[model samples]
Target: MLRFGLVGALGIILAIASPALPAAAQKRFPSSAGELTVDTVASGLEHPWGLAFLPDGRALVTERPGRLRLVETDGKLSRPISGIPSVMARGQGGLLGIALDPEFAQNRLIYLSFSEPRAGGNGTSVARGRLNEQGTALGDVTVIFRQMPTIASNMHFGSRLVFDRTGALFVTVGERYTQRDQAQNPANHLGKIIRIRPDGSVPADNPRKPGWAGEVWSIGHRNVQGAALHPDTGQLWTAEHGARGGDEINTPKAGLNYGWPVITYGVDYSGAKIGEGTAKPGMEQPLFYWDPSIAPSGAAFYTGTAWPQWKNSLFVGALAGGLLTRLSTEGEKVTGEERLLTDIDARIRDVVQGPDGFLYLLTDEEDGKLLRVRPAR
Candidate 1:
């Protein structure tokens, strides 16, 4: 029953004030470990979705409106960089997940996930490019992977890019709202977590089912928004949206089928039953699930010494709850939960740990903000 720190009787007084407070005001909040300060790093972003820190401490940020910018530690933002491939930018489809190449320091490469336009509609796709030295343009960008059977819907493009320790890239895609049943089919890319090499090739050791799509790592996901490799074990973990309830936290393994519409801890928003039941043989179960969905987006496991008491805590940004949810983890399982940043009152689109051991967050808004959370003086 512990939060991220030592709750020394004043834990109840840690509540924050309104999120409208000026960024320069240096508002502080009490926490079990110590006081936390929330500072605005940058603003004017339109629904910023993903963040990846550069070697020099600057960050590449993506706005869902199909623009990309570089943000500095001091809150200065670069112009929307040139050379981003076109994005659909319709409904939930747009520029989404991003990550640096594991060998970025030597190769200057980066990857981006977006909803690519197709004949029928759009689907999630990943592209790689070299970031120019000045960080002003992406060069030699090429689409490496495109989800199959693009449908005529924009609602469920699960785009989160995470790189495993072995340098394999994991891309999460959702079952297009009208294609829930496709989640159960391994032959298609919808509602699936795909694993691939950095160069768009399938790995030699990837999971294989008879007639399984070579890149499909696991299937039966709804609309996964949060995906991260466990900081300790290197397993891919994800948090996905559900209908009325049934938000799930899963560590997807190779060749496994995580039942979506077939087995959910939820019902349709219209109160109609979904799937056969919550559990069945031959389908993988979530390590943890939420009954009342939180609409989780970004994920990061705190590995910072700044908050020693918070080491290894899994932090998830909630778009629906407008808060940051910290789950205490014991290996692969979530044991306890604490919701923070409630006073911010912003739909947190993505959260990442900075190079300096602090937390950085992107708010999901037209005039979205990049916020820094750190120890207060």
Candidate 2:
């Protein structure tokens, strides 16, 4: 682990203190991180959102415009896979997160999170399907879980999916802008982390009681787009986008509230202060945060053998800031942070370590590209 002393760490501490940190501190990152070599492995994507790596080295990516594509190890970008369910491709709602089944070796199954269109409006849903031999067709797609109440507007669709070691699926949903107060409502699924069986059935051990509508694991999130279980501790860590300034990195506790609108490091988009204050007694505080919101999107922990020094660190993608941040951690606490691939100047949507011990990135744009980062030898 590397230590930068108290003076350097003060900037990070002050960012989460409130909304008074300077812009220079917001942009300043670690000065060094060894050699990093980045390459455009695949291109020609349309607003790529989420990504998952297969055991055989293929990559499954979701495009916000309602398409899923496979990128082979040889850098071949395959055609869009068919049989994806219809998506409400509005502002932020559309085809979102993807994850391979924990037992994918035998099942050849994959899970997806997307906006499901309904009579009244659209709601986020989790679907599972099998990948075909050529990776161009989705067979036997099944809807396992769907958000309870569909609503209008398309801003905050906190759709990120990941499976824990137990094979249970964890899905996130945004407030949907229909109801701000619904975030604290255990009866509503909006702005909550839901834990369910692979087939979409509610888990018996969900953080909430049996009478609740769905399996809400945690609540009070504005738009949590990034989520990953810590490699060492098995705890779930999330990165959420704030309205104007507050972007938070938190280790979500079961049944604990994460206070979004009520207490935030951010204000409204029009530059007005949000809620009453930045912290409250009941709400859990963030482990780390950014004042001038980076609009964090995807998250993953580095445990691959290729970069042993990077093991246990967090890799997060920034959409608004257009950078890839590597957060060094000591146990459950973040001690250091470095920004990489800022020269690419693209809205990084997702970051993951590939099967081959390399880093993979998905850019968010009309012609988004898949990038690979390896050690510069």
Candidate 3:
């Protein structure tokens, strides 16, 4: 009896000392979609950064610490799948994003973007791999697209993989923070959006310029983190992070320059003015921008029928703000904004729509969670 009492007392003391754990399974919250419930599908993920739903409803998830996991439907996370390339898991770098082939069921191919350790330091690179039948490992892994002039910095590896309707892959590259000025220089891949074929070849139709890389689709971007193809227009849309302010949403067109260091609505970290004011004659402007930065990440447009009111709404996960941002858009312009799930107070790293018409989210914590959003009973 004495031993049992001591163990019980210790459990209570530890619970009091530790921070509150997020509610298990399901919790209710109010939102524009009416009363909704967030179910904790799985926990104990280490900085989970990407999520890709398989045809079987399982998901391939990546941890920033260099592991790929398969999350089963019943909330079991398979052991780290084998054959992930050696990643330079440094600051703002690591295994970043993943995308499925359009015909994944047939080809079993998947693409991943991660920071690759190079001779100098590291840069973001995309790799393609085949998932074996048992789903226990990735095989035939091949490095497809590698960002140019591999620098030594660890910050600003904007590496999201998105595929267009014509099957072209769009890879977003960052300016490697310390090299923000290169974002304006087309001589390198830094700070540009590049479109390439699945086989890692530059498309013949890709934009061409004297000094621009052949794979360059657009240039003059800051660190773009969130990106998705518009459900209605099929056009590529991206979310970018500004210095101190000026978080922006942009629809990047081929060969266009998005004013970053040259023109910005943000100031530097030291509170100094940045750029030559906010506009330039030839530079493209953002569709919408946030003055106080939200540090936006993975994005998805709600096309699922689970919530009719949320249809066509663009959902973006906020890492710094610890919430989900819903932007109501018409045509190419943002009309309204709704910030939801702030009460959870977790850093939302990725937002995705499941095949079951429900929404899913990844929290970027030491012990991150895979959460599902559905209507509350």
Candidate 4:
């Protein structure tokens, strides 16, 4: 069982296991979709994933190799910012998402997601800190939320952080590549989107039974890397990677089960079908799905002024598909889908709208890049 106390810990060193992909599955990578143009805004980064625009017109990026960087508006990359704690970078686990406190104007608080070591094992953790005067190192850091009951596996640490309009925080955790069953259990944090206070306390209004923990907002997911609240509806939306197929975009209701391994439209990596047949009665279906798997990561709604025709569309980053997907949303339904930047062929890991009204993306790779997207004339 997972324990719930707090202490400084170190992750277990992985034994250099063989690659998780099946032998026959290895092939040329970087999938691309329909035609849409993309342009590079900046280059020269190490596995850039998460992005957060600061109030000063600069943006902060988290590289999976455990570095936090400051990118100015003119595309200049600052020296690595300090104060990030140690992280386990084995497989998909590492420094993940970044978000400023909704009340950052007064508090100067920021949140981060990373894989932290713990007793008996390691798991995904969230920490908070303040940026220093020089915008370099973070100071006054504290761990707000840490997954209990660490395990030995090193894959599927979802670790996406987003602050809703109400100042409540939503965190996503993968099933750790071993606890697939926990995705359907209300008792576990794995494969779930958790809702908490900015200070890391479980809110009273969470979808818990009278005596159960209240942090669980929705359950039954598989590595949900992208989560964002709809700009007009105030509803929460998420994108998750499926096994061999069945990438999904879902709007989760309080207490709804999303049907991960139990009823997936996807098959296992070995080409075996997963779960019972799709469409279980109690589980919610995806608002949209991608077959052959886009391996989606970050997501956000486009409310910026630069893209006049995309005023309320949803932008999703694809890790496997190597493109950004634009979705049309109306009343919680996805009406149309378009693939963007298929020609660039970069692993688009995170997408966010800049305060300057342009779209930004961070690529995923050993040598990744930071890119900006605008409407082509």
The models' CA-based lDDT, in order, is: 0.84, 0.79, 0.84, 0.76
Clashing pairs in 4: 2-149, 11-117
What does the lDDT read for residue 318 in candidate 3? 82
lDDT (tens digit, per residue) of candidate 1 on 123-206? 899999999999999999999999998889989999899988888999999998999999999999999999999999998879
* lDDT of model number 3: 0.84
TM-score of each candidate structure, all chains considered together: 0.93, 0.90, 0.93, 0.88
* Model 3 TM-score, 2 decimals: 0.93
Total colliding residue pairs, candidate 1: 0
Q: Looking at model 4, which ten-residue stretch has the lowest summed lDDT?
A: 10-19
Error of 4 at 371 (Å): 0.6
The residue-level lDDT of candidate 2 at 40 comes to 77
For lDDT, candidate 3 versus 4, the one ahead is 3
Tens digits of lDDT, candidate 3, 55-149: 88888899998999998867788999999999999898999999999989999999999999999888999999999988898999999999988
Q: What C-alpha lDDT, on a 0 to 100 scale, does residue 271 get in candidate 4?
A: 94
Q: Residue 95 CA error for candidate 2 (Å)?
A: 0.7
Error of 2 at 267 (Å): 0.8
